[model samples]
Target: MDTGMIIQHRRSSNIHSLISYHAHVGAVTSIAWNLFYPRVFGSSSADWTVKIWLLDCFTPIQVLDLSSPVGGLAWASSSSTVFVAVTDDGRAHVFDIRLCKTRSLCTQQIRQAHWPALSCVVFSPFEPVILVAGERGFILSLKLSPNLRKLHKEARGADEEKLKELERQKMERIISTSAIS
Candidate 1:
């Protein structure tokens, strides 16, 4: 089955080339583009793979294999530094585009953090981080490096404590009001 299609009209041929691409051995169901590069990317459910292609080229430039069907794909435009792909098994594969012409360096792989499937992945515009949304209403933000993760954890603890203190004050206010009445 044709997963995704793009059509181009040629004046000389008086016809259009209907190009249909399959992401994997299975059907290519969805396609995404890199905002900062002239590249196109697509994913398929049948074979659970993500393929990257140069614009106007039918052949894929790179193929990323996944253990489970792919649910989402994303590319960073800030420097064309990274490409991220998420799968049904809650695994995210991070690749470095700079090394694509030489060695295939998978910068990072996150596993078992998401349940069901990750439906979408996006990068933060203000920071070097990624946000993933998964099935069962699961939302998570993954930082590129360990330093960010540690800072995030510390910030979360502080926020939780602040919330708890606010709750305690709210309860005290209600008790005093009721006692006076």
Candidate 2:
């Protein structure tokens, strides 16, 4: 299998290449940037792996294997460390790096008997819900439980800068811990 590569370009500087990531052993299926962190992103692949990466680092900070080809992935709008991935096996996998890095927090089948494989996933910007799209034009919306979302009461009162700082710290902690392990 050909190794999947991700090339980063400087968006403003004449579209020049800035960095390259050798992400997976199969085609890269999807890429999603963290809503709160400019430098953090995640990529899913046909090789059945989803990897979280930092712009300055060549290596992935964390990797999750789904045991089936990943169709697509999207970062949660409410949290910097949370994301959801859809797979060819008709399931949606949710991950929160703060809660666990080695395995998904939830894996639920979204495709029914006659439905096609899931092709993409997107989190709602205003609510704790996600919409998964299947290859055959089927779209399903799922509401996330409070535990999966981890929405704190304090976040409502916190200023944007403060919330961003907290999120940055959370991501930093994950990176530091992953490096140690």
**Candidate with the greatest lDDT versus the true structure:** 2
Best candidate, TM-score: 2
In candidate 2, how many Å is residue 4 off? Answer: 1.0
Q: Write the per-residue lDDT of candidate 1 for residues 1-181, one digit (tens) a residue.
A: 4434443334455655555443355655456665544434444453676766655666666566666777777775333435677777777776654435332344344446535677778878778789988776778888776432233222355664564454344334433433222
TM-score of 2: 0.90
Query: lDDT tens string, model 2, 70-158?
Result: 99999988788889999999999988888888888998987877778888899999988999998878888999987787655657789
C-alpha root-mean-square deviation, each candidate:
19.2, 2.3
The alpha-carbon deviation from the true structure for residue 2 of candidate 1, after best TM-score superposition, in angstroms, is 7.2
